[model samples]
Target: MELSSFLLAVIEDLGADLDPPTRYTRYVNALVAALPGNACALLKMEGKALKPLAVHGLTPDSLGRRFELSEHPRLNAIVTYRGVTHFPNKSTLPDPYDGLLEGVHAGDLNVHDCMGCALHVNGKLWGAITLDSLRAGVFDARVERAMAMFARLGEAVVNVAGLSESAAAWRPDTLNVKDLGMLEAVQLARHDMIGDSDAMHTLKREIQTVSRSQLAVLVHGETGVGKELVAQALHAMSDRANLPLVVINCAALPDQLIESELFGHVKGAFSGADNNRQGKFEMANGGTLFLDEVGELSASAQAKLLRVLQSGQVQRVGSDREHQVDVRIVAASNRDLAAEVKAGRFRADLYHRLCVYPLHIPPLRERGDDVVLLAGYFLEQNRSRLGLRNLRLGRGCEAALKHYSWPGNVRELEHTLGRAALKARRDGLGAMVTVELEHLDLLSELPTQACAVINSVNNAARMSMPMGEVSYREAIDGFSKNLIQRVLVETQGNRAAAARQLGLDSGNFHRMLKRLELL
Candidate 1:
């Protein structure tokens, strides 16, 4: 591929009206055509980390991994140097993409050629573009000059893409030391929400739009779908970012103590009220109060919360004096509050108040390749924790991860990768540990014995029903009850193990048991 051809291709792409992600992807593709390497990546610097925005000839999971300057010396060198820095074949610095290149093993990268240049737009340091080849002496003087020219084109591409609303909304700024740690924490919270799928892109746009408004947001998602992370991002991107973010887990509090917990209690107010205390509302006076599992609030608790939200005031349990506090509300729930309202389990008024701006997070199964990307993120954490030089998915593992239905969503994927990494480490795959498919504990696909039990129970449930016709809902409930009981009996009443075997969250399974009157 020639430089002239690359320029012509970029111009053609720019002339077409495309989304920011698609535009950036086309730009990387063009860069790969003009560069002299098997792999090319366009990374954007965020605080002290470099995030891959687009890549060519690299594994899909590479987009999920963040390269920190303190961890990857080669990237640090590329970002700090002005000119194109080409590393010798014997350079001591380790490659961040070890075991990450498509169809290339970590062992094959011992003496590969690498070169990169820091990109700039409007005279400010934007990010970096890197190119790598598995063979030595691939990045010669001519290729170096070509990289420099392509780097300039990369800047122009970013400049054109930055005009879009989505790209302009999330442009990262260079931060100092004081803000870096805070930014890192915020980034970690944003990590789980990473994906280029249409569902994710819509959620992100909705977040950006609602974060600036003061209306209450109700985040709805399945268990392990990261509702809390969505709340964190909402608060962080809101006007109240610098203020405190108070979190209250509604399900964790007892029915008898929920009022005192939210409204605070005076001395001798109740059995354990020995000292003056401040409740969650007062503590979050000028900030955001995150109510996790808002559907679990008791009837009495719901009335008190509604009063406070209506009046912007809270009255202590033992005192009549009401204190005024301005607090923003961001509530999250795994259960369908609308369904709960219809069933009379949750208050309809309170539901309406909390759901002013409803934000729904897509389940993991709906996000196609995001599973692999998130797997890479967790694998990186495990690699650092287990003291392995590199951790990556082996042959067919990516397919296994992407094809299976993630019932528990991101949380289950995190746990699955952690366990797989440990198992692979125990197998002594040396410094470059490759997690194979067998190491994954994917419970969505049950064993033959378990399947047989489920089948038998389902048939028995149907046959035992009365002769009269029944609704589909009733039939499903009967089968579900029998299946839960069978699993419980098989596990010897270990609810956690039973839930695992049935591919359900423990809390969800417990709720099912209660609903079916099997508790």
Candidate 2:
């Protein structure tokens, strides 16, 4: 096809109401068809690297890799010149696609010729498009000019798609609640953070604002509220999006290894340390390091961490040499770090450093109708995972979900929906599976006599009627334990089901079991 015809086709595709991925895929495919090359790829400039948006004649794994401008000289040259860049067959610069092409040997680097042009939109360098060949001199002056023209058209299509996505993300203030819900559903699917509530909007705005800076970010939230997702969104929206996002769970690491994990260790630093190794900080150089459950770090570890944050230098265990690292820190904690600092458990200096920009994620119970929106998102995921033709919520299920106090937050809701979907499928509710209230087993969660019993106990100092010499408080405790045990037996040891049956949130149910010495 002619370059003009292909460009027109891409423009038409962009004009449609397609998703971002689909629009990018169609545009790249058209570019490959018009260009003279064995392989072509479209990469978007993100932070200090170029991220692959779409590709032709390359391995799928290439999509997962980012080409940092500092690491690829030829690609950097292309972006800098903002024009056609042609590399001769004998060019010494390394090819980013050295072994990525299909049918190429895993260790071979035989790409003979390559050319690329920087993609600019509205006077800013947005990305680049490249063409590669196995034969030399394929990208002559005429071919270079033709590719440049296509790159201009490609940039226009990309800009339009971006605008469309942004427009779909938010509806006008005039939109009704139902219309807003529909718009939010589309936006939620495309984004990692899922909600349209005011609290969610405020959190998203904070993420966008903080992402533009280099300061440390502290994400505070309750357990299971998706602190990691917040960290991910922060990194993805930041200028360092294309760089590594190294994550370390402080709560999961052993005290003895925390230092080594964060600051590396030289060979023989300790038993079993056979070779020198880089730690999370070095690995995340020029990127982001997400420290999850930061409140769990030991006092000594916190001291070392504070030093790194202050100096931007990490010293290996048992080594005197310090390596400079350029890493952004994003820490998350369920605990109140301020309280920990006041209690002398956490270092005050470290707490202040991480809290330079704090973001709090709202609990699921407070998000109102966002529960229904999230349910739809998880339902669709379950449908695709289970290979079911359709999966949806039945009557009253949405109300039940929103009404229940989700003490376990977003994580709990996701698991509940997943388990319910599986149960529905197993119960012979084939292709068209609608998750009924019964499927959720939440009828037992209706307000029961337990509340009334507690109220009566609170009102009276002592019950006139005592059971077998036990005090009123003891009697009530025994009765609650027996009721929970019976429910557990009925549910065959499914604590979540038993909790729902006993009119309790799963977190509260667990706490009750712990108090009764039954957990």
Candidate 3:
């Protein structure tokens, strides 16, 4: 094929955002007029080294095929001069490009015959492209010109990427969320919450780091120890606070409508997309997009999301024209992404990028001083919130609060405090509010356990043996043991609290603990 057509094809490929693996060989073949005797290569600047970008002529057995940029004068000169550098005589060349190369020769590849061009775009050195031949004089004027042109094409492609970013900066989202990592307490704290525990301090610091960068952040925690609260704090402190902080519950959204909700659709895109619609990206254009329970996203949805994040562009469900968007993503999940990745249920790359800075909210039971501090803050807030006159936790109640293993984390605490406060505010009955949570009931969790027990009973009843006579007590005990073990893990080995939560007195709890061999 003619060298011009080859170079043109190379330009087209680069325009397609060519992947790294084959980009070098394709460019080398297109630029070198006559094929080099064996293998040829293109090396580019990376950190402190000029690593091989593409290798073609390396022996099926040649060692040290990769050459270092700093160690090699040829590649270094390419980075330094920001122009084409050729062999010994440049005075005989057609004309001066950057006039970069005067008397340079590539000695590191140690190949006797080769030329290289430095890739620069908007005055910055991006990389270099080299066209080498085993035979001397193989790269003629036509070949040299094509190499230079295609190098410019590579630069042009990078320039286009730069343009996309610049355009994103001017768009509503990028400009608004100037600092997506900030964790300012003023914007987030509804009441004065004073907690100097290590957990709280670490959380605050993470909030600050996430506030400064526009990257995906993953917030992980058990069922509500303030995971969503942390996400809200992120949004409130970020530059996008003024814009919509759109929150989507991936767990709640149905699979069928999730795509339409997230990416929007044209009129008639689906059965119910009657009118043209804008998706979450468009809605969250000028702000932070918070996705709760993101781990619940379907596999297909994860791929589409991965594409949007990778490209910074989104196409509506039905439409073909992809809208360029600038959206900062902050996702929260209760599941372990590492496990998900291992299970092949989640993309590894997406997991790393999303967890660029992971902030794991400590459960209430594990927050050290934050537990008391946050509980007090919630108490007062609930007081005003529910119009309670005067209610307080009794000495025993305070001890119970501190002693019980809060399995549901902050959500459980919130529910407990809110209900306790409401009960203490009895007016018509004229009942004096006592601090003793004797009425706290601590027994609401039984309905769930009872439901499980009922199911077990029904399954056992199918055996045709007299119901309740054949003691499946062992099975029930095993189930309880498993539940206890899981709760112990969640509570980090607070045995007393775990026993109290199981509704056992200290003596009975000890016996059960001994039976379970869980001293």
lDDT of each: 0.80, 0.75, 0.60
C-alpha TM-score for every candidate = 0.79, 0.53, 0.49
Q: Model 2, range 404-472, lDDT digits (tens) per residue?
A: 677789888888989999987887433356676778766566454544444443333144233235433
The local lDDT score (0 to 100) that residue 382 gets in candidate 3 is 58
lDDT of 3 at 366: 54
Higher-scoring candidate on TM-score, 1 or 2 = 1
Name the better of 1 and 3 by lDDT: 1
Candidate 3 lDDT over residue span 366-409, tens digit each: 55434444455455455447644333443224335544568887
- Each candidate structure's count of clashing pairs: 0, 0, 11
Consecutive 10-residue window with the lowest summed lDDT within model 2? 173-182
TM-score of candidate 2 to 2 decimals: 0.53
CA lDDT of 191 in candidate 3?
Answer: 24
Error of 2 at 272 (Å): 0.6
Better structure of 1 and 2 per lDDT: 1
* Runs with alpha carbons beyond 4 Å of true place in candidate 3: 1-194, 426-432, 443-519
